[model samples]
Target: MNSKEFLNELKKYSNDLLVSMSFDQIFKEELLKLYPRKIINCHAGKLPFYRDRNILNWALINNEKEFGISVHFIDKGINTGDIILQKTYEIKDSDDYTTLLNLCHKECASLLYESLILFLEDNVKAYKQKRKKKGGGNI
Candidate 1:
């Protein structure tokens, strides 16, 4: 079924929360209108910094000493929503893409579980990302 149709069916249920993981499609505005801040997602990146796709590859290419998993509210922008929880894992010298990805998979699962528990208990808070100033370098 299409997203709209799926959402239409979803509205029949009484649940007030939606959790998304690794969903490639964007939620339609109509769905967002109905759900608003009720939709949440877990990302394998730190967010805002690694907002778009291929985050793990980029982190490895950038030689980052650490990588992060983030759970946040789903907003219009890609991974620009308020952060609910984040945890970082150190990048060991012997780690490859596969190993790092496996680590992230585990951490992401744990973070998602904890975040959901906190959210259900009303102990979680969303923090908006602080905007950074654009560079003024001349073209």
Candidate 2:
């Protein structure tokens, strides 16, 4: 369904919170307006880094020794919202596509749960992700 129709259907629900898990497509502005920054999303890759699609494959292709999972608020720009939680993991020589995928699956579930709890308790201290600068250490 289109965003408007989907939103109309969502209005039938009683909950006030919205969380998007593995939602590959970006939401239309109509749906985004419904929750503003309150809509949270769970992304498998580190923000401002392994964003977009095929992130896992990219990581493997790059022979990355570390990976991450990020849970953040969804904004107009995909994977560019303030981060709620970001956890990194080490990749070993034995780790392959399936292994990495499974690790992310596990971490994403637990971390998303933790992030929501922190939000509910009003204890979350979200920070904007800084992209890597020409000579900067942060990204």
Sliding window of 10 residues with minimal summed lDDT for model 1: 130-139
RMSD from true fold, candidate 1 = 3.4
* TM-scores for every candidate against the unseen true structure: 0.90, 0.89
Query: Any residue pairs clashing in model 2, and if so which?
Result: none
Best candidate according to TM-score: 1
Q: Give the C-alpha miss distance for residue 25 in model 1, angstroms.
A: 0.8
lDDT of 2 by residue, 1-139 (tens): 2366788998788655688887768877887777777788888787768777767777888888887889998888878899999988888999988998998888989998998899789888889988755643122
Q: Compared with the true structure, what per-residue lDDT tens digits does model 1 show for residues 41-122?
A: 9988876577777778878788889888899998877777899998888888899899988887888889889988987899
